[model samples]
Target: MPKNSIQFQKSFSIPEFIQMYGTEMQCRERLFHLRWKNGYVCPDCGSKSYCELKSRPLYQ
Candidate 1:
């Protein structure tokens, strides 16, 4: 690894990580944002029109 490797950078402490993703809802929201930073986009048809399923943590 290089001296300034990205993995070696400590952006947040362990406590901070727990604080951000310490719950199911938190984790879900983070995943959603990471997946669709500019909003949801369909992988198949490349459509932005989609809906969230309340029965589970999923979007279709």
Candidate 2:
């Protein structure tokens, strides 16, 4: 049989994970990209212009 598809996935140790996503900013940036692979867009008006909210995790 062929190798399992999961075998091709990248593996990381705890230290590696921490190095890549240990900070809040890093986590947020990763999430933002994952959520919007094509960059951010306004949900209300479909505009690309937006201001990142400082008090909360949102775009306005």
Candidate 3:
């Protein structure tokens, strides 16, 4: 292992991470954005139009 190789794994402290993503909605939005960089698309039919399920954390 190299000395600087581990630098790529650097991360924010616990407090800072919580301050940035402290809410359920914030975390969900972040995940959504990361998962769909070009906007939401249906994995089943290859459609871009879809709606979010109210009672669950899913897209339909």
Best by TM-score: 3
The estimated TM-scores of all candidates read 0.65, 0.67, 0.70
Worst 10 residues of 2 by lDDT: 49-58
lDDT of 2 by residue, 1-60 (tens): 888889888899999988878999888888889998999888889998888788987789
lDDT of 1 by residue, 1-60 (tens): 358678678698889999999998898889889989998899999999988898986689
Local accuracy of candidate 3 as per-residue lDDT tens digits, 1-60 = 567866777799999888768898888888889999999988889999988888987799
Residue 49's lDDT within candidate 3 is 91
Superior candidate under TM-score, 2 versus 3 = 3
For model 1, the stretches where C-alpha displacement exceeds 4 angstroms are 1-7, 53-57
- State the local distance difference test value for candidate 3: 0.86
Poorest lDDT segment (10 consecutive residues) of candidate 1: 1-10
- CA lDDT of every candidate: 0.87, 0.87, 0.86
User: What are the clash counts of all predictions, listed in order?
Assistant: 0, 0, 0
Which is the better candidate, 2 or 3, if ranked by lDDT?
2
Model 3 misplaced regions, further than 4 Å: 1-8
